[model samples]
Target: MKKITNAFRLTLSLILIAVVFSGCLIREVEQPATVKTGGEFQVKLTITDKTADANAHYGAVCVLAPDDWEFVSGSYDSQVGTGIFLFDSSAKPVYGNIDSVLAPPAGMKWIKLLSDAAFTNPADVIHEATINLKVGQKTGDYNIGYFTTKNSADLLGSLNMSDEDNDNAWSDTSMNHKVTVELAVGVEDEKVVPTKFSLDQNYPNPFNPETTIRYSLPVSGYTTLKVYDILGKEIAVLVNGSKQAGQHSVQFSANNLQLTSGIYFYELRVGDSSASDKSEFSEFKETKKMILTK
Candidate 1:
């Protein structure tokens, strides 16, 4: 009976080995552990395995973003996949069989999300989205996750039940497919600010190829900083966007515009963005003179 016992022990060991090897096929999404709200930040979506694996092809990916955050823009370096994003107030929370045809049905607001195009190498796919805190957004922790629609075997049409060949690697298929991130909102309130809007004179006035212009805003608003020649003709737009209430600076490069040595004026215009005091700062504009030698 000793020979029989040895054979049984060997068989049991082989079964345990097969079970352990078959458990690590799927992968989870990784991202930063924390992000600051109010300020713009990037949400990166990447797989654990960094190597460009040959079998990592995915047909579709769906990402569910936090409801309170505002969608800014997608990362400029999105890999070979087209994306569709939505942010509708009338949208409702929709979660279910992500692979189902009706998962992301029409009109789902409050959820800023992205649906990716098919035919992508999972390992090579690195996605990023820029987001910021919605006006008056509360600070807290949030989770962001994605679900893949098609696995490697499902893409290549080699679906099988058992891992006899161990060819599949779609390991992470949990329901809560997300990573947690802490968001600290309203942190800007404690920061200092100027009492009023002001624009300072550019340094190195007679600059060779570049000069710097400094300006400050007392409150959050849309700002426009433009460079104009002595004749009031616009030379270049240095800054044109919404900015927080703080001191800001931008550089002027005369090398690209082929601007000759001459006197130029820079102007700063501020427009109210808050609905409560929309007309309070309608007439905020400042101008400063600068000279460029070469």
Candidate 2:
């Protein structure tokens, strides 16, 4: 009887440990290994609220970058991700410059994006953010940091402290992530921006199930990327919202679509977002074909 009681206590202790450590799950969706001297580098983050606290919610996402990367306030494009962490009806991210008495860890700076997203109930919510940057002339391997919080108060105790020692730096293992990027020297631009609109063909022309599509925009606009069958029926809407001016890529897979082996066409459409009708077309209405084998 005593052994049974001890086993019950052990199971209860393990459950408590899991509850204490599981807060949010942040994963590195996509990133670059190397970038040109003044070229575009991208990072995609997938964050899910696991604890889903009813008292306070997470509405802000932050990035910790090396100062030499020169991630100035006006350097890169900050577009609203077409995810649940939206700022308004049109889905734009509220770019904020957090400068004052607060500073990030030495040699690093924080880029905070506040949204109207919530974990109001007990359900888990997922949010994604894609950040595109044109790094400076500095060339070397550097680590980029990422985190999300409810507000500034949760971050006050984390400044400059080592991640292993700073309990307040982040809530769980997923909240604190580090990504390394190698930068090479090349033609440096005064500011990083796409020169024009372009739509590259799908990679791995004869992919069995998965492939990637790349595109670029010189300016911010309402854009849509779609995949169609040989007969022109829409199969998937890859992107349909406002996109910041820079280089971007999206992946397509056939596992969920139950697609058969054949030729497929993908189209990219962009227009001036200021007008009521954005599909009138100013620079791009391009389509390309790719082959998928079963």
* Per-candidate TM-score against the hidden true structure: 0.34, 0.40
Model 1 CA deviation exceeding 4 Å by range: 1-191, 275-283
lDDT of each: 0.43, 0.50
How many steric overlaps does candidate 2 have? 0
Task: Report per-prediction Cα RMSD to one decimal.
Answer: 19.7, 18.3
Encode model 2's per-residue lDDT on 225-271: one tens digit a residue: 99999999999999998889987899998888978888788999998
- In terms of lDDT, the poorest run of 10 residues in model 2 is 10-19
Candidate achieving the largest TM-score: 2
Model 1 quality (TM-score): 0.34
